[model samples]
Target chain A: MSEWSKNELGQYEYAGGKEDWEKVEQIASLCEKFVIDEEDELVSDEERSCYNCRFRRWTKSAFVCMRR
Target chain B: MKIFVGIDDSRRLDGGGAGEIVSLLTRTIDEKGWGKSAIPSRHRLYPHPDTGYRKHNTARSFSAEVKEQYMEELIDYACVMIKSNGTSDSNSGLAIAVPERMDNTDELIDYAYRTKETMINSDEALAMAKKPGLYIFELSGNGKGIIGALAAVGLRMTGNDGQFRGKLQLGTGEGYIATVKEIIEKSHIEQVKNMDFENLGTEESVRMGEKVKVVLLDHQYTLMVFPTDRQHPRWQTSTTNMLRIF
Candidate 1:
């Protein structure tokens, strides 16, 4: 969560690469707004992980969390 | 005849994804006896800036075999589905292509790849479809979805891109550890291979992890596994993070 930075788009982009499954899960566990995305967009098996959250839009190097 | 169906831009901020909608469409095709379809393949497009795309720009597509008479019926059904299901804020489009009718497939595939790098509009996509005698339809909203829908058919025809949506159940239940042979025999998965692209023997067993998904390789639904640790079931199903490269 500390690694997240707010982009000009106002979304919180994960500082970690797109594959940071553990970090995504750790952060998602502490947040109450995690909503799992559709199966095609999911990258983590941990259902509640940020990597699987619909609000997390993917970028070339990482992803941005759209939910505040 | 083999027909390819592609759909995109069906989700809005309210809630929905093109992949989920495509899966439901495929199921309906099967239930109605329209045709048997392969697993839906997700083809990603260029994430054009300010295009109103939610996350990444990706489209869902699948190939179905049906009688020549049912071709029009199938396309009509897909159009109706997209119109009824697409989110109000999104510009949904559907494309149906019969590759055999296309005079030049290389151009289509090249266009599909180009979409990954640049911004393309409906006019360009429409021109390409007209030249190939391909079918493209705008289901709702701004009609920009035609770009992804047409590109999806092209990329799928190439047989070299896209990750299959959802997991391929390797065992009777989720997370069931089973041998490679058992997995192949019991499920639709044709082969099991390691992450390094090495084939695992039939006797080798791997744990079906929570996300037991596959990618389209050599036109096969391949379940790729990786060695996570030195244990009895030394291998585990590859995660979406690993499969994302495809």
Candidate 2:
């Protein structure tokens, strides 16, 4: 597995300097943390923050962060 | 035969107010005569009934119902068209759009399951889809439209075990490049493993600002990207940037 650098918020950025990869991981993590594996089905701050992030945008049905 | 399109009111709103996008799409279809061969019908379901008490309480229920009806109509129309045409031709398609604000991902999953149930159990719709030439074009929205459609059609997210994933297909052109650049710049991030334009689809990984064409294929669906070099100033903000045929 490749190593990644985490920012102040515990968000991970890719070591190769690929921002889209970082964005994709951030989004995937957010989905895992807030949208998936929960009965309540609420969008948490981490997920919402991802939505507001530059690498990502919220879709009508899903949160679309960049993927490479 | 019929074609159905999902309309989300919020995204249609702008400085001029809501309904502009819908009007534009309707006009384009009308002018182009795309759906003229088969009758086109629309059903508008609000998040809340116009004259209901305590709109907040009924919002979820109302949205669910609207989505349910929309999916049912698409299935119904596809079945009719297939039976009449005797094949799963290009004409048998459904186009859908959703609002950006309705981002409850679980609700979308639920909606997909329900759609699957209806399709599996209905004799009429199922029989018509014997060949199952169904195409779903998810217009740009909050990304939920495509995600929901992908889930409804059973595309699981790979590598994450149970997690679901949806992919966006962009055409090779300046517009697509601009879109990628905006996504990267807005995302506040950097590099990707591969950058070759021709090898994009085959590459194991892609970068933030690469140009490529995407095709989605399955037994029942085919999504194709046709590149147009002309750029629209509003394409970035417009939800109609992408087209889905199902």
Q: Pick the DockQ winner.
A: 1
Candidates' RMSD to native: 2.8, 20.2
- Candidate 2 lDDT, tens digit per residue, B91-182? 12222323232233344334434432332222322322232333343233222222223332221111100100123334442344333343
Q: After superposition, how far is residue B55 of candidate 1 from its true place, in Å?
A: 4.8
Going through the candidates in the order shown, the clash numbers are 0, 25
The local lDDT score (0 to 100) that residue B88 gets in candidate 1 is 70
**lDDT (10s digit) by residue, model 1, range B64-122:** 88777777787888888888876676688898888778787788889888987788988
What TM-score would you give candidate 1 relative to the actual structure?
0.86
lDDT of 1 by residue, A1-68 (tens): 57877766676667897667787789999988888777877666678898777776666557777677
Clashing pairs in 1: none
The DockQ of predicted model 1 stands at 0.46
